[model samples]
Target: MKKKLIFLTNIFLCILFIRFVSAAGTAGSLNINIIESQCLLDFGEGWNFFSFCRNLIDKNASNVFSSAENNYRYIMRWNQEKQEFDIFSPRSSRNPVPDLNDDESYFIYFYSNSYLDVNGTSPGDESRNLVEGWNAPSYQLGFSKTIDSLTLPIEYQYRYIMKWNLSRQEFDIFSQKSLKNPFGTIDQEEGFFIYSKEDLILNIFNMQ
Candidate 1:
C-alpha cells in the first residue's frame, strides 16, 4: 500500500511537469503578425518622390514596378554613402538599383499618371538610422503628418526639410528658423530629404 501511494504521487508530479512545460512553450512561442496592412501609392508625370510605409513581402524593384513597367521611364534611389543617385531603368540591362526598402525613398519618372497598389506588413517599433548630412527617409506611418509633428532623437537636429515639387520640378523647402516655411505636411507614400546635424537613430513615427 505504501509503495502504491508513492507511485501515484510520482505520476501526479510528472503530469504537473508536463503541464508546466507546455505552458512555458506556449508563452515563449507567441506569434506576432508584422505584415498586417496594405498601402496604395499614386505616381504622376515627371518626378514622383515616394517610399513604402510598410514592410514589403517582395522588395525587388522590377517586381514592385511591374504594373507600371510601360509607364515609367526610370527609378532612382539616393546613395547616402556615396552621395549620388543610383538609377534603374527597366530598359537598361545593367541596373544599379535592385530592391526597394521600407525606410528608404526613391524617385520614379513616369510618362503619364499611374498608381501602384501594394500589400505590406506594418513597420512595428522600427526605427531608421540617419547619418550626418543629407538623408532621404520615408515616413512609415499610415496617415498624413506635418513636419512639426516629427520628433528627433536627443542631441540630433534637423537642418532643413525638402520635398520634391512634381509640377515645378523644384524643392519645397522647410526650416524651423525660417520666417515663412512653405513645406508644411508630409503625406503618405511621400518621400522627402532631410539634413541632419548629427548621426543618430530616428524614430520615424510615434507608435502611440
Candidate 2:
C-alpha cells in the first residue's frame, strides 16, 4: 500500500511539471542567475511576474523600484483586458494588481542591487519594448533564438544586437558591418543590448 502511494505521488509530480512547460509555450523555462550587478531585468521566463515582485518586496524585503517613504518595486504586468502593459507600484493601494501571464513579460529596474538565486517552474512568456537607442534585454528560453527567426529588417539605418555570452561572461556584437555571422543563435536567459533605428516591440512569445 505504501509503495503504491509513492508511485502515485511521482505520477502527480510529473503531471505538474508537464503542465508547467505546456503553459510556458514558446518562452520555455525561467532559469537565470545574477552573476553581476547594475542592470534592469525582466522576470526570467515561466514566472508569475507580480508574484515574483511581491516575493521580493513583501517576503524577501528587497527593493525593486521604490523610495524609502514607499518601499516597493516598479513592475509592469500585462493587462489582457486592456491589451497593454501597466505599471505596478506595490505601495499604492489604487494600483490594479495583475498576474504576469504565460504569454507575456515585462521589465523592472532594481536600484538596490542584490544577488538572486532563482529556481522554480511556473509558466510564463517573453516580450520587450525597444526604444530608439541602446536597450538592455534578455531572452527567457531554455534554448536559443536565431536572428533570421527574429526577422530584423536590414534596411534599418541603425541596428545592433549585442548578446551577452553567459559562459564567457562577455558581449558579442552583431550588425551588418560585423563580419561575424549575424544569423547566429542568441542563447537562453542571455541578456543583450539592442540599438534600434526607431521605437519597436519585440515579441518572442510566439517563438518556438
Candidate 3:
C-alpha cells in the first residue's frame, strides 16, 4: 500500500510539470504572432516624414497609400545617387516613384489629418547601407529609441541626424559633438536623415 501511494504522487507531479511547460510555449507563440501582425502610423496635415517599420505584403506605392488616397497630396523619396526628390502624386499621370522600400524613407504631403494602417510581417534585424553623403533611412523597429542608443560600427561616423518638424515645418537636428541638440529620440512611425562621413552598414536589432 505504501509503495503504491508513493508511485501515484510521483506521477501526479510529472503531469503538472508537463502541463506547465505546454502552457508557457503557447503563450510565447501568441505574443510573436501579435507583434508581427500590423503597424499603425498617424500623419498630420502637410509634409510628414515617414517610413514603414514592417515588410508589407504589397510594397507598391499605390497599395501602401490606398488608405489615405484622398487625404494625401504626394509622396516624395530622396534620390541618393541623383541628388533629387522622386515624386509620386496620385493626381499626376506619370509618377517617378513606383515602389516603397523598407529601408528607405519618404516625405508625404497630406491635405488633412490621416493615418496609415499597414498589415505586414515584422522586419527582423533591420540594416541599411549608408553612403558617403546624406541618406534618408527609416527606423525599422516597432518601438521608439534615442539617437545615442543606436549601435554602429567603429569605422562608421555620423556627422548629423535630422528629423522633420511637422508643425513648425523645419528640421530638428541632432549632432553628436554639439552641446545643444534638439532631436534626441527616434520614433518608429517617422523617418530621419543621417549624414555619414564614410560608407558603412547601420544595423538595428528588433527588440520587440
Give per-residue CA lDDT, model 3, range 165-184, as digits (tens). 88887888888788989867
State TM-scores per candidate: 0.78, 0.42, 0.79
| lDDT of candidate 2 over 1-208, digit per residue (tens) | 0000011111113212222346547544544433221222233222112122111212222233323223225665544344455776656666554343323334443344323333233224546666667655445554455765653442463477765432243456788576775336655444455666776677665356
User: Mind sharing the TM-score for model 1?
Assistant: 0.78
Which residue pairs does candidate 3 place in steric collision? Answer: none
* Candidate 1 lDDT by residue in tens digits, 1-208: 0000011111112212222336446533333333245556767788888777567888998998899899999888988778789999999888988888788888889999886766566565657777888888877665666676664453238788888888787789888788899767777657888888888777765443
- Worst lDDT run of 10 residues, candidate 2, spans 1-10
lDDT of each: 0.71, 0.43, 0.73
Name model 3 segments beyond 4 Å from true.
1-36, 154-156
State model 1's lDDT. 0.71
- Find the candidate with the highest lDDT and give its number: 3
